[model samples]
Target: MATAGKDTTDASGGPGNTATPAIRHSKPPVNHHRAPRAATYSTSILPFERSPNGNILAAFCRAAYWTQGRAVWGALTASGDTKHCYKMDHARRGRAIIINNETFHHDLYLGQRTGTDRDAENMESLLSELGFDITARKNCTAAEMKSMLVEAARESQGDADCFVCVILSHGDDGAVYGTDESVKVEDLVAPIKACKSLAGKPKLFFIQACRGKFVDGGVEVVDSKGKHGQDDEEEMESDEVAVQTIPVEADFLMAYSVAQGYYSWRNREQGSWFVQAVVKVVRDNWRRMDLLTMMTRVSHKVAYDFESNVPSNRFLHMKKQIPCITSMLTKDLYFTPKV
Candidate 1:
């Protein structure tokens, strides 16, 4: 996130003007947490309840969606490779919210996620390497998630440059499993946006869950390293607002692992396709490529390189997935951690 990609105008890596990017689904309002919230890093355990619906492999690409913050958000870890990263203080990089829900009411849930913890572990390692102070938790209920987001935003000290949140759980389009129940993507955004402390700051949300129950049946094609759809330039839609006014919810970037209404893929032991692609791209091209470019590469990796090997015939068609990103950033973003 070295603010190097400010010039990006391509749909894949640019400041988009969509007033409110339309997502595949929406959730009911999350009643803002009224109680005094606990510090994000406290030793307190997450309160829990149980039962659910959502989907299979919805949490498959939670790590895959870890884009939307600084263009090279994780490049802080690659400081040995980038000279500019050493110019900024690494301690001020900011905070990240990592929610990995693996356990649920077995009788009521579809199935237990056997490999999600691996994704969470790998994610924490990558984020830490990149310089984020992480507030990680597991098996949280819907209410806790809402309260957590509000607190995360409110407690975000003004000195930090950005905020990040990653949710890895069972989900259905704009909704994710909260151990005992499901919550909407919009509900999560509303409270964080309501917090005045984080206004005007770049915030990113990376969601790894199923948007719907669909699969991509790929057609045979010769392999090539060519850019897939560079020529198609669609005009951006814009809406004017009052001058100098910052909407309560501006400067957010959302990176979803799989496209809406489709299944996400992950290995039982290695981790998710999206997460792996992101780590590889940012690690190898930290300075040469910006975060937006890395995210586009992530989509390409998931869409073309990986394929599912689930034994069931029902899962055969789930051989591919495409990552999605939506942004409302108004300025350039970078990850220039001080030496």
Candidate 2:
């Protein structure tokens, strides 16, 4: 239980005079082998054959198919074709602002977000790889967060493809926390949406926080193939976009870590499940998948690949989460990977 250092005022002097907490730079080792209370479900294993050249033929075939399919799709949705998909061929991929609120003021009564630094780090890395200039902040107050977003919106984005803002904090249904107070999620988006330079460009927001306090005790589903084995060892494996808007709200995508009235779980060492899933999914499939499709995979990964492992609290143990995605865009949005 390491305590955060004393807070200091933001140098930008935009708003909220409250002191910001010192950011924790220590990286804890991730625990990936935690035992589950119940037997884990396993995924089906696919058989593979090796070619005469010692290559995995199935893998090579799959790769080839993926590449060829994307090439065709890319041709169909060529640049300047806003009818089928948004153009992602600008000189810049645009800017990303990551406001990570890890520690709260003592008066706020909120516990520190133990693993959020990892989330911020991963998000920054992923967005940078996607060619967005990154502006990251830690432990901002509500006013400071709002001020930053407003300032970001004021910047010139005429040559950029899109805008992205990622907030990692404790939150309720429609808002997220700052160091001192909570800020409306809509307020965070309004500034960016109203920016004239980004009018037709995509605006993406990824919020990783608890939407509420309710825990989801997942329902059991019977497998169609047969009954599952009782032994723990036997049950081990398994696993958008658009835009257009002449409309004010069009072309914006809001991705929430959990559904309204549900808690979003985080590993004290590994960060939030939703952020991890988003980073991995985007990194793996951005070259071919649309933003919405990648987000759907993110939702599936968070919903099925993670479960709360709180052993001491029966009410919290084995809880589940499902991410919520709200899209207002009118066209398919893909992140055409940079050369």
Model 1, span 1-339: residue lDDT tens: 100111111122222121321212112223332333433663423221110222212222222333433335455455543433222333476778888765554433334444567777777766665667788877777777787788776784566667788888767777786666677788888867775656766787888776776676666678733222222111111111112212325678788888767766555455566677776776655444555667778778767766544333444422556788776766545554333
Best by lDDT: 2
Q: Write down the lDDT of every candidate, Cα atoms only.
A: 0.57, 0.69
After superposing candidate 2 on the true structure, give the runs of residues whose Cα lies further than 4 Å from its correct spot.
1-17, 20-73, 78-82, 223-248
**TM-score: which candidate is best?**
2
User: Candidate 2: TM-score?
Assistant: 0.73
Candidate 2 lDDT, 1-339, residue by residue in tens:
111122211222222336754433222223343332332454332222233333344445546655754684667657646476887878888888889887666655566666678889888888876778878888888998998899889999998999999999877777788877777787777789789999888999898876766778877766312122111111000000111212227888888888877777666555777888999998788777789999999887776666655444567555677899989988888776543
Report how far residue 73 has shifted in candidate 1, in Å.
Answer: 13
Worst 10 residues of 1 by lDDT: 1-10
Model 1 misplaced stretches (Cα beyond 4 Å): 1-91, 224-249, 311-318
Candidate 2 residue-pair clash tally? 9
Q: Estimate each model's TM-score.
A: 0.65, 0.73
